[model samples]
Target: MLTLSIFAVLLLMLLIDIPIAVAIGLTAVVFFVAQGQSSFLAMLPQRMYSGTTGFTLLAIPFFILAGNLMNCGGTTQRLFRFARALVGHVPGGVGQVSVVSSMIFSGMSGSAVADAAGLGQIQHRAMVDAGYKPTISAAIVAGASTIGPVIPPSIPFVLYGAITSVSVSRLFLAGAIPGAVMGLAMMLAIWLMAKPRNLPKDPRANLHEIWDSFTAAFLPLMAPVIIIGGITTGFFTPTEASVIASLYALALGFLYRDLTWKEIPAILFTSLKQTCGLMFIIATANFFGWFTIFERIPDALITQLAAFGTTATGFIWIVIAIVLVLGCFIDGNAIFLITLPIFMKLCPLYGVDMVNFGVVMTLLIMIGNLTPPVGMCLFAVESFAKVGIWSLAYECFPYLIAILAVTILCAFVPEIALWLPNYVMGAAG
Candidate 1:
């Protein structure tokens, strides 16, 4: 039972505040050591190197750099104005702006915490100043931030593609419809909650203002186009697209005159810092995945699950439930890296479509980001807004349900996740 023991050690390490990358790598080491497989120790370096050396993974650092550059390039204010022009007249004007801005920003950041801390704080302050309850404001920001990872250029999708050899471009297309549906669903939830509270509504933007804001946002808005369009049209690989996106973001910084040459070094350093941490986790998780395979965990799980009378849809529902429960206590990326190997292996056996499964898994794990106790976005918003975690979680419940409904819809109607991909990329195998 070395597998079980090593897993226990990993959980214990996390509970004791060990970093995930270290915990995972250490756990794998424990497995090998305890088994007296000293010979395998020599191969550790090679395994780690092989895991991180995938050409597809080269895209990660570039994308992270592109995101950092976009953030530093004065895109937020322009996008905020554009979102306000579009949705500031909705029932919950300030709150709707948070949702719409997140949708726009998600195309760039691909990060919930970044979205929550950046645009989220802006929306949170606005809603609070408009006399909304701090709890409600906190909930709106947290809920909308969940959209960050589901939109195009999501970092999580990149990780999944790197691990599973799925086409990153197809994964981007798969997220389009479901992401939009989620944004609309959250907006509807916002409208319903704010209707009872009589929240303030900003005046609808006239054509002139809307046009001006859109014009201002033009360069920043072209980011996803430059990245996605270039990748889809076969002009560049996803890796090359990231490099191109990074340069475009830098040029936009010069054009905007907000990001300066003097500040470039610090920005690169910060981006490098973040990328290194993620790359470590990816590397360690790859180590863990290798050991798990060596232990035949997937085989054991398949045999165990086979006896349960599982069918494709039934199995998906069960996986969703388990993922949701685990998500409450673990980081989403960790959860994804830890569980995807097992679940992805189950796909062909259950007759599940890998593309659809990847999309659904990404969405479901993100919904976990708003879950209570340890939801990353929840804590990030709570800390900044200074709202009680449970209080904000309570307010986010309805929105959580709205997200769950979307997850279920996308889960059953695979077309919700696959339609765009199939239409654009041809049928996935």
Candidate 2:
């Protein structure tokens, strides 16, 4: 009864449009008072502080700064050009470029909205100017942006690792193959939809043109290689890699002269704001997670699932479904923080691999970012496209289906996400 009420209040708060952090924090406080345990309230500050103090989380700000720097440094345009040079003549034309470029940019940003809002502007304008429908263009950009968080250096992956004590380096490696597969699947979906939609095909670039674009984007492209390579080789932890990524992006900005000294303040301010918002969420989520554990919610959930005789595979599918459904209604990070403590408990009980489960969870969260009502990428695309959110969601259906297939594939085949990490890191301890 107590668990049911806590969830009911949380759900009501969310439906009533409260800020997620406030809703979560208040829900915990209100319940504590209701239970006459207001004395526990004094520890809230410490609980929130403990949550934000993880060393792994130190990567978040720098990664955000790196992405902001890259965005301002004019890296995105170069990536778009490179992707276009490489695949613009494919059946889907610029649609293929959106998928490929987003995959590359994903490595740098580790953020869906950043990809959607920054590179997306370039992709959207090109697609529309090339004669694609507004809705279709927006949908394609939004769909492609989902790839950002699935690739390496993902912010969500970082938070997941910090919260669950998983290895951030291994999580980064695990995402590579699945992220690549997602890009390929999206491109294939675009190809199949091309003739029917009559998607425009750009003239194929000659070798010289491809070489020119590649050279132009070369430094920007190295951002991911440096990050993943540094971590894999033990030269730097993920946190240090983020700092290196930021410095590298800053250097490239000055080298290209695309970003000036005047812009640095704004970029830093923007990154700070984003970081603060995320940190607050982490803080409140920590308290909420503690509340759940205190309420013995995980134990209760395990009891219920055990009664059903849930297998490892079955548990994974259930998590996927929950994330997809809740994703439509809530922010991905909020959902992740709220459910992860409980889910982590189930992982061991069912003998699931945390590394594989982490990848799968990250994938599902990316898919959620592409859904309706509160889909961050959708809003980012809609800001410029003027297409109704529902319409954009409808047009994104094919790409969503493509990504969903990959998510289902990953769920069934742990080796798909596990292989690269195990090979590179020599398997998790």
lDDT of each: 0.83, 0.91
Q: Residues 1-429, candidate 1, lDDT per residue (tens digit)?
A: 555676678778887888988888888888788788767767677777887888877877777776677666677778888998998998999889989989988877777777887778778888888788899999999999889878887878888898888898898888878989999999998888777888888899999999999999998888888778987888988778778877887898899897999889988998799788887887788778888888889898788778887778788988899789778866788877788877888888988877778878888888788887678999889888988888888889988888899989998999998988888878843
* Model 1 misplaced stretches (Cα beyond 4 Å): 1-6
lDDT of 2 by residue, 213-242 (tens): 999999899889989999999999999998
Tell me the TM-score of each prediction against the true structure: 0.94, 0.98
Q: Which 10-residue window in model 1 sums to the lowest lDDT?
A: 1-10
Q: Number of clashes in every candidate structure?
A: 0, 0
Report the number of the highest-TM-score candidate: 2
Best candidate according to lDDT? 2
TM for candidate 1 is 0.94
lDDT of 1: 0.83
